[model samples]
Target chain A: MSRVGIRELAAELGMSISTVSRAMNARSDVSAATRERVTAAAERLGYRPNQSGRTLRRGATGTVALVIQTNTARTEMGETFYFNLCDGLQQTLATRSLDLVVLPVGASADRDRFLVNAVDRHLADAYIVSNTDRTDRRIEYLTQRAVPFVTLGRGGAADHAWLDLDFEGVAAHSVARLAGLGHERIALASDDRDINSTWEYACGYRRALAEHELPADGGWEIRVPDTPEGGTVLADRLLDMSPRPTAVVLAQETLAIGLYRRLREAGVEPGRDLAVVGFRKNPVCDYLVPSLTSFEVSLVDYGRRLGEIVIGLLTASPDDEPVHEVWEMTVVPGESDAHPPCEKAAG
Target chain B: MSRVGIRELAAELGMSISTVSRAMNARSDVSAATRERVTAAAERLGYRPNQSGRTLRRGATGTVALVIQTNTARTEMGETFYFNLCDGLQQTLATRSLDLVVLPVGASADRDRFLVNAVDRHLADAYIVSNTDRTDRRIEYLTQRAVPFVTLGRGGAADHAWLDLDFEGVAAHSVARLAGLGHERIALASDDRDINSTWEYACGYRRALAEHELPADGGWEIRVPDTPEGGTVLADRLLDMSPRPTAVVLAQETLAIGLYRRLREAGVEPGRDLAVVGFRKNPVCDYLVPSLTSFEVSLVDYGRRLGEIVIGLLTASPDDEPVHEVWEMTVVPGESDAHPPCEKAAG
Candidate 1:
C-alpha cells in the first residue's frame, strides 16, 4: 500500500491542513479531542511525517551535530576517547528521539571556514563543538548568530553551555600522589597546543607544587604534541636533565607506551628507576609491562552529561541559566607508578 | 541587507520562479544566455539557494553519513581505525563540497530500529555502512529500498558497492611467514563474530595449512572477542594445548598487548618461546617490548577510496557498474614474530 500524506490525512479527518499539521505536531492551540482524532487517523492511515516538510515548518531538524576535529595526530589516540563520548551522547540523545551526527572537520586551512558555512547552512539544529583552543573563534561566531550550542571544552568570553574535564584537578592529584611517594623532583608532559585544557593542566601542576612546598621549575614542564613521538621526546629530555626527574606525569595516556619504550632504551626502567603517571586510562594501559598508572573518567557518563545539558538548553526558556559541568577525574593506580625511586635524584 | 531568496531573485530577473531555479541549477532546458544572466544577477545580489528548497527540487541532500556501530568492545581499538578512515573520507568529500556525517549506532536493542528509521527519514543522501556481518539485514534492506550505499565489509546476496580488507590474503601471508620460520603448527585468533571477514580469515588459514602439507586442526583456530581480554583468553588456551602451536596469528592488533602480558606472566617470551603476528599495525604495537609484527593498511587511503566509490555511485547512471575495492595489507615485520620455537614441546 502507498504511504499516506498529510493532505490525505486532513481530507480523511475533514480538518484544515494547517489544523491537522498543528495537531500532529502537538501544538497547544489544537483542541485535545481534535489532536487525539488526528493522531489516531494518522496512525491508522500509516502516515509518516515528511522530515523536510516538518523542518521547513518548525525550523528544527531534530538532530545534533558533534563537530570534532580530525588530523593525523589526533586520529591515532584520540579516537577511542571521542568514540566512547559519542556513543554515550548517542545513548542519551536516542531517548529524546534526537539523532547524533558526528561531523569530522579535517586539519586544514579552511577548517574554520567550513564550520562557519555549516552553521550558516543550518546543517544541524544544535552543535557540540569539541577540540576548542584557548581563543576559539567558533564560540564567538555561534554566539553572535544566536545558534544553540554546547562546547566540550571551555573557550573565551562566550556565555554558552559547556562541559569540561577537570584537568587541573587531575594534575593536582597526580602531583600529590607522586609527592607522597617521596618524590620531590617531578616533570609534567602536557599538550603544547594553546588548547584550554593544556593551560588548565599547567596551572594545576604549578598550584600543586606550591601547595606541597616544592619548587615549580619551568624547565621541568615539557610542552609536547599529544602523540607517541612526543612522549619519546619528553623521555629523552628527562634523561638529559642535570640530575633527572625521579618521576614524570603525562597528560596524555597514549604517550605512556612511547615513554616506556624511550625509558627502556635509555637504560631506565619505569616504576623502578623512574615512576610515570598518565592522565587518562586507555585499553593499552592495562597491557603495559608495568601497567600504566593513569586517571580514569567514564566517557559514557561524560557524553550523557553533555546530552542532558544540551537538551536542557535547547528546551529551556530564553532567560534560563546556561549549563556548566566539570567532570572530576580519578586516578587508577598501576605498577607504572608503584613507589618512589630507591635513589633520590635532583634535577 | 536581508537575504535575497528565490522569489525576490525571480522578480528582479523578470522570470518564472521555476525557470530561474532551473537556470541557477544548470538544467539544460535553460538557454545559455539566460543561465549566464541569472547567475550574474544571483552573484550581484548575493543570492544563495536555500538547501531545503534545493533538496525538495533535486531529491538529494549534499551530505553522506557513515553509520558506524559503537560499543565497549569496538571502542577499545576500533576507534583509531575508523577515525582515520573518516578523516580520509572527509578530506576527499571536502574537495567536492559534500559534507560527511558520522552516525554512530549504539549496541543496544534499538540499533537496527534506529538505522531503519534513519533510512526511512532520508537522514542522509547516502550511507556508508560499516561493521557488516555475514548476513547483514541492513544490506538487503538498503538494496530493496534502492538506497545508495557502500558497505565497508561484504554482506550476503546484495549487488552493491563494497570495500573490504583482504583478510584472506593477510591470513595466508601470516601462515606462510611463520611456516617459513619452521613453525609446523600455528593458530589463528580472529573475531568471534559471524562477520564475513572472519569466514574469509578461516578459509585463508586452512588453505595455507593444506598447501604446506600440515594438519588443519580445528582446535588450533581460536575465535575470540576483538579485545585485549580476548587475547589473554587465547593465550591461556595456548598454555593448555597438548602440543602448543609455536606461532599464532592475531586478527586484531590490540590483542597483542594482553597476549604479551599473559605470555610473560606464564614465562613464555613471545619472540623466543612463541611467535605472534598481528593483523593490523596500531600505535601500541610499536611500543610492545617485543614489538608486534602486523599488517598495515593506510586508513586514510582506505577512506579516500570509499569516498571515491560512494561519490561515483551517487553520480553514476542507473546502468553503471557498481564499484568494489579490496585493500591488500602489507606486513610490517617487528620483533614479536622474529623466529619460531627451537623445540616443539607438549604442554
Candidate 2:
C-alpha cells in the first residue's frame, strides 16, 4: 500500500502541514484539542519522529522566503543564486530538515495583495525581504500584522528585523577610495531600479559627499536603470558634460559594464581617463578586459540567516520581542578603480 | 489579542494539521475516535476555519518540490525556466493555495530523503524532478517507492509520471539544419559537469549523425566542463585537429559563450567563422553580440503539468496508472548554422 503522506492526511484533516507537525511534535503551546487529535493519529499511524520530521515540526520551518521584484528586474542572484541559496539552506536546514521557498512579486503587482496572498497564508515561518524600499507596503503590512520578517537591506524605518549592508557606510568607503586616487571631479552612475533602492544609495552618496567636502552638484548624480545598456547610455550622457568627471561609482554591476563599453567607445580608458567603482559584483567581473572593482554580499549566508530569523519569529510567542539581526558587507578591489592622475578637489 | 493560528493549535495537538483540519472539516474517512477528540477541543477554543487552515488541509499542500542534484555536478534549469515553471505552477495551484519548494539535493541527500524527510516530515505533497537524466537516482527512487513524482526535460527508462522534451527527434532536426547549411564535418561540444546530461546530448548527436549517414569521428566529440573557460580551452584544441569540424553543436549555453570568446580572440566570428549551434537558449541570448540560436523548452508548462500530475496522484486512487507526459521542444534560428550546398543521402 502506498504510504499515506502529509498531503493526503492534510486533505482529510483540513489543516496545514506546519500545523500538523507542530501539534504532533507536542510543541507544548499547541491547543489541548489539537494535541489530543494529533497524539491520537501518531498513535494510530505509528508516526514516530525522524530527523527532518522533528525539525519540520519545530515552530521553525527551516524555511525562509526571499521577496524580490519581478524576474526581469533581477540582475544579481540569477538562476544560480536561487539554486545555490536553496542548496545552502537545505544543507544547514536538512541537518535539522528545513526548506527554502522563493516568492517573486510582479512589477505591477499590488503589494498588499501579494504579501497577504503570497505570505499571510503562513507557509514559511519567517521571511527574508530583498530589494526593499523605504515606503514598502508589504513591510508596513507585515509590521501591522506583526509577522516575523527580515529585510535584506535597511527598510524605510529601522524598527524591523533586517540583515542589511550599510549603504551610507559603503558610500563613504567608495568616496574615500576615490579621494585617495586624486580624482576630484567625479560622476555618479546610479541605477534607479526602484525609488527605495535609489533613495538609500543616494542618501549614502550625499552623506559621503558632505563628509568629503565635495560639491553635491545636480549633474554629479546621473540616475538610470541598472543594466549594461543603461550604463552605456548614462556614460555617454555623463561624458557629454564639458569637463567631465574623472571618476565614477557605478551603483549596479551591469551598469558598470555598460560604463566600460561607453568609455571604450569614447576612447576613454577606464584606468587612465575614468577610474570607476561598482556595487554588487556579478560573474565576468575578472573576465572583463579591465576587470571590475565592486562590493560583495554573501547571498548564501543571507538565506541561512533569513531561515533562522523567520523560523524564530514563527515559533516565538506573539508577545515576544521582535528579533532583529545585522549583516556585514565588504569591498573588493579590481583594475577599474586604479588611480588616474591626481587633481584638485571641486569644493 | 492576536488570534491563535491553526499551526499553533496543531503544534500543541501532537498531530499534523491535516488530521486536525480533517477532523474539523469532518471528512467521513477519519475515524469517529479522531473526530470527536479534535472537534471537542476545537469547540472549546472557539477555533473557526481559518482560510489557510481551510485551504492547506482541504487539498494538496499546493506545494511541489523541484528536485535537482546539489553535488559536484549540476544539471539545473535557467532563470526563465525556473520562474516560468513557478509562474505556471502558481497559476494552477494558487487559487488552491499551493507553493513551490526549491529542493537542491546535497551530496549525501537522495530522492528517498525527499520523500521521508521532505514529504513525510515537512509539508509537501509531491515533487518535480528537474534535470532528470538516464538512470537518475531520484527518479528510480521515486518510482520504486510509489511516491508522487514528475520529470522535466530528461527521463529514465522506468515507466512512471514524467514530462520530457523530445530530445531524440530534436537531434534529427539539428542534423537537418546542419545538412541544409552545407556542412559535412560536424563536431559536438559536450559538458563534462554531469555524465548523465552529457550522455543524453551525446546520444542525441549520435542519433542525428546516424540519420544523416554521417560518421561520428574521433574529433567529432569534445568533452569539457560546463563553463565558458572550458569552451575557450576546448576551442584551440578543436581547431588543431587534422580534419577540423566545419560545424559544431554545443550542448550547453555557457560553453557556447566560451566558444564565442575564444573564436573572437582567434579573430573569428561565430556565424561567419564556424557554423555553431547549441541547446538551451540562455538568459543573455539576445544581448549576445550576435544572438544565439538554440532550443526553448517549455519549462513553465512542464512544471505546471508536473504539478497537476502530482495533485492527481495525491487525490486519485492508489491503483491508478502513472500519468506520462512528453513535452515538445522548439528550435530557434540565429546566425549560427547554414545548410550544405548539396543534398546528402538520408540514413
Candidate 3:
C-alpha cells in the first residue's frame, strides 16, 4: 500500500490540507473535534509526514547538539564521565530517531558566538549544555533566544530544565563518614573554578562540619586545579598544615590517584597515614594500592534522565513548568578511608 | 567593509555567474588560468560566499563528522585520547570556518544505518573514521559513496589518507629494550580484536624476537580484551604458566594498573617480580605505585596531523596522491620495566 500524504488524508476526510497540517501539528487554531477527526483519518490511511518537508515547515532540525569547550589550561578529569554520558544520551535519543551532534568549541571566548551561529543555521532542534558556571551567561542568552536546552549541571535560573549531580549529598556523606572514623581535623580539596558544583560541594562541606561539631579551619580547605600536578602541589600544602588533617576529601575523583602517589613518595600511606575519600568512583579507583574510597553515580541513568527532561521541555506546552532534577550518588567504601593512626592505636 | 557576494564579484570580473562558480569550485571544466584568476578576483574583492547558499549549491554541509560506536563490553580506555584529538581537530577546523560534529553510534549494528542517514541528509561534507579493523566495510561504503574522508588508523587500500601510530616500531623498541636487559622470556599482552594495530604489533614482536635470537614461546603471546578486567584474567593466566614470563608488554596502558593489583594480591610485585611495559603513557601511569614504562605520543600533534590529512584530502584534486603518514611514539621509561631478578643477580 502507498503511504498517504497530508493532502490525500485531507481529501479522504473532506478537510483542507492546511486544516489537516494544523491538526497534525497540534495547533490551537484547529478545533478539538476537527483535530481528532483529522488525526484518526490520517492514522487509518497510514499517512506519514515527509521528514524534510516537516522540518522546513516547523523549523525543527530533528537533531540535538552538545557544545563542549576544551579547557587548555588543565587536563580534563571528566573525559570518561562525559564519554559514558554521551553514549547514554545517544542511546536514549536514538529511540526517538533524533540525532545527537557534539560540537567541540576550542576557545572559551568563542563559545557564545559559535552557539548563536549554530542556532541561526537551524542546525539542531535543542541543545545540551555542560560545564556550567555559577553565573553562566549562556543560560541567559539561550533563555532570551527562547531555545530549548537542558544543562548537565546547575547554573541557570530555576525555570530552565537541569540535571545536576548531588554534590551536597556527596560532601555531606564524606564528612559524616570521616567524622564517624574519629577525624576532627579534616581537609577538603576542591576545583579552583567558578562552576556551581564547586560551590555546592563547599556548602555541603561547611554544613557537615558544623553538624559534626568540627572546627572549620580556613587553611584546611584548599582550591587546586584538577590534575595530577595540582594534587602533588596540594600534597605539600596539606603536609605543611599546623595540625595536619587526618582525613582529606577530594571534590573530584581524578585527583585521588595523584594524591596517593605524592603522599606515598613522602612516606605517607593513603589509608593509614591520612584517610582519603574521592567524590566519584572510576575504573582507576579499583587499581589504586589501597583502593580509593569514592562515590559512584550511574552515568547512564543520569544521561537518560537528562534526555527525558529535555524531550519533555521541547514537546511541552508553553505553560508547562520546567523540570529540575538532582541525582544522588552512592559511596563505595575502600581501604583508602580508615581511622587516624592515633584513634586506631587507642582503639 | 561589507562582504562582497559571488554575483558582484562575477559582474566585476565580467564573467557569467556559472563560470565564476565553476572556476571557484576548481572544476575540471574551468581552465587552470581561469580558475586562478577567478580565485584572485574573489580574494581581492573580499568576496565571501554565503555559507548556506553555497552549501545548497554544492551539496556540502561545511561540516566534518566523526562517528564513534560505543563498545558496551569493555571500559573505554581511549576516552581521553579521543577527546583530546577531537579538540585538536576542532581547533584546526575553526581556522577554516568549518564545524566538527561528533556522532556517537550506540550499537554496532546501528552504525551503518546511522552513517547512511547522516550522508543521505547531507549532515556533513566529510568523515573521520577511527578504531579501524583490518577488513572494515565502512571504507568500502564511504568510497562507493564518493564522500571525502580520513582514517586515524591504517586499513582499506593505499589510495586513502590515514595517519596511524607506529605500533610495529613500538613493539620492536620494547622487545629490543627487554632483550638488552638480558630477558629472554618476555611475554606480550595484545588485544583480541581483529584490528590492524594488533596484527602490526604482533608482527613487530615476532620480528624483534627473531632478530634478538630469542626462542619464541607460543604461550607467551596472550590475547585478551583491552580492559582492566581482561588484565586481571591475563595476570592469572601468566602466573599459571609453567615457567612464568619474566616481563610482559601490554598493547593498552589502562590495563597496567589492574595487572599490578592482581600481581600484588598474589604476592608478586611489579617491577620486582615481573617487569611490565605499557603501550601508552597516560595520567594514570604516573599514579601507579611503581609508575608505568610506556610510549608517549603527543595527542595534540596526532590530532592536528589527522585534521590536516582530512583537510588536504577534502581540498585536493581527484588525481592527487592520498597521504599516508605513520607517527612514531617515544618511550618514557619508568620503574615498570626492569631487569629480571636472575639477570640483576648475574650482573
Candidate 4:
C-alpha cells in the first residue's frame, strides 16, 4: 500500500487542504473540535505531512547541526567528551521538539566550505560548531551572515555567542597546587591544534608561573597530538630535558594514561617520580592505579546550557543580547597530583 | 547583503528556473554549453539552491540517516566503535555527494516510534539503524514500507539488508582456545541488553561448550552492563561462585579493564589466576597491565561497506537482491589470555 499523505487525508475528510493543514498543525485559527477530528482522522488514515513541505512553509528545518571534526586518532576519552556533550544537547532540544543532527567534517575536507554550504542549503535551523580555532573563519562567516548559531568554544569574534571551558582556571589551579607543593619547575602539555582552549591553557600556565615567581622556560611548553602515542612522546621529551620538570599538567586526559604507562616501563612512577594532572575524570582514568587528578565538569549540564542559549537565540527578537559564557570545571584531586615533587626526575 | 538564491541566478542569466536547475544538476537534457554558463554564473553570483526545494522536487533528501542508540552507560569502547564506523560511512557517502546525519535515539525514547517518525517525515534517502534487537518492529516497519534501509546488525526481518559482527565466531574461538588449554570450567560474559549480538554470542558459547563435551552450567552465563563498573560486579560474582571458572571470555573490552582491576585487588592476577579474553582491542585496553587478547576489526572498512550497501539499496532497482553479510573480526593475541587453567581452587 502507498503511504498516506496529507492530500489523501484531506480528500478523504471532504475538506480543503488549508483547513486540514491548519487543523493538523494545531493553529490558533483552527477550532478545537476540528483539530481533534482532523488529528484522529489523520492518525486513522496513517497520514504524515512531508517534512520538506513543512520545512519550506515554516522557513525552518527544526533541526540543529552540530559540526564535529573527524580524525582517525580520536581517543575513547575524546569520544566520551562528545557523547556526553551530545547527550545533554539532545535532551535539551527534545523539550522544544527539535532534533539534533551531528555532522562530522572529515580531516581531509574543507571545514569552512562545509559549514558555508550547510548554511547556504539551509540544512538546519541552527548550528553548533565544535573544535573552534582562535582565529576561526567559520565564526566570522556565521557572525557576518547573522545566522542563529552557537559555538562550543570561544573564537576571535567576541560579539557572537559562544561557551568556552574554563581551561585557564584548570591550569591556574593545577599550577597553584603543584607550586604550593614546592615544585619550582612545571611543564604544560596540550594538543598541537591552535585552538582557543589550548591558547587559553598555555596563557594560564604562563600567568601561574609568573605569580609563583618561577621562570618560564620555553622548553617546558609541549604541543603534541592528543593520542596515547603522543603521551609516550611527551614522556620522552620530558626525560630528554637537561633538568626534567617535577610536575606536568596535561590539557587532555588520554595523554596522562599513555604517560603513566610509559613512565612506569621506564621505572618512573607517576605520582612519586613526576606529578601529573589530567584535564577530565574519564572512565578509563578510573583504571589508573593512583587515580588521575583531573578537572571535572558536568558535560550534560553544559550541553543543556548551550541548548538553552541556542534556542533562546533562535526564538528571541533581533535586539536581544548574545550570550558569551565560560563553563567552570572543578578539580577532582587524586593520587596522581598528591605528591609534592620528584626527588630524582629521570630514571 | 542578502544571500544569493537560484531564483536570483536564473534572473541574472536569462534562463528559466527549470533550465537553470537542470543545468546545475548536470541533467543530460541541458546542453553542455548551457550547463557551463549556468555553473559559471552560479559561482559568480554565490547562488545556492535551497535544500528543501530540491528535496521536494527530487523526492529525496540527498542525505542518509544513521540511527545510533543513546544510553548514559555508553562506554569508551562504544564510542570508538561508533566513531570509526561513522568515519567510514561518511567517507563512502561523500563519494555520492550525499551527507551522513547521525540521529541518536535517547535511552528513554521509543526507538521504534523514532524510526517510524523519521521515515514518515522523509528525513533521508536511506537509513542505517544500529543496535538492532532480536525481534525489532522497526525492521518490520521498514521492510513493509519498502523503504531504502540497512541495519548495522541483524534483526528478526531476514529479507532486509543487514551487516552483523561475527560474535558467534568470537565466542566459539575463545571457548575453543580455553578448552584446548586444559580448562574444563569456562564462563561467558556479555552485556545485559537483549540485542542480536548478545543472543548470538550466547548461542555460540553454548554450541562451543557442547562440542567440548563440557557441562553447560546456567550459573556460568553472566549478563551485566557494558561499563567498567559492570566488570567490577562481574569480578565479585566470579569470586562468589562455588567453583569459580578457571577461564572467562568477555564480550566487551571495557568489562575486562574493570574485571582486571577488581581481580588484582583480590590478589587474583588476570592472566595467571584466570584466563581472560576480551572482545575488542580498545585504546584503554592497551593500558591493561597484561595486554588483552581480543578481536580487531577495521571499523572504517566495515562502515564503508555499510555505506556502499545502503547506497546500492537506495539507487538499485527494486528487484535487486538484498545483502546480508557477516563481518569477520581477527583475533589479536595478548598476554591476558595466554595462561592455562589456574592450579589453585581459591586464592
Per residue, candidate 1 scores C-alpha lDDT tens digits across A1-347 of 33365567888999855567557657576789999999999889887543222222113567888998777465775366777887768777776678888888765536678779888767788889988888998888888888888999877554788878888888899889989998888899888888888888888889999999877778999887788788888888888997788888887777777788898887788888888888878765655768888887777767766776666656655555675656766678888889776474333
Report lDDT (Cα) of residue B322, candidate 1: 69
lDDT of 4 by residue, A110-202 (tens): 999989978886778888998888899999898889778888888865788887888888898899999999988899999998888899898
* lDDT minimum window of 10 residues, candidate 1 chain B: B50-59
Listed models, DockQ each: 0.39, 0.14, 0.27, 0.23
Backbone clash pairs for candidate 1 read: none
Q: Candidate 3 docking: what grade? A: acceptable
Residue A321 local lDDT, model 2: 51
User: Candidate 2, residues A236-256: lDDT per residue as tens digits?
Assistant: 886787667878776666676
lDDT of 3 by residue, B224-326 (tens): 8887788888889888886778888887777786788798888788888788888878764556768788887766656655665566656655555666667
TM-score for candidate 1, residues paired by index: 0.81
Model 4 CA deviation exceeding 4 Å by range = A1-58, A76-78, A345-347, B1-58, B76-78, B345-347
**Model 2 chain A: worst 10 consecutive residues (lDDT sum):** A48-57
Worst ten-residue run, lDDT, model 3 chain A? A50-59
B247 Cα displacement, candidate 2 (Å): 2.2
Give fnat for candidate 4: 0.33
Q: What is the lDDT of residue B262 in candidate 3?
A: 94
Error of 3 at B196 (Å): 1.6
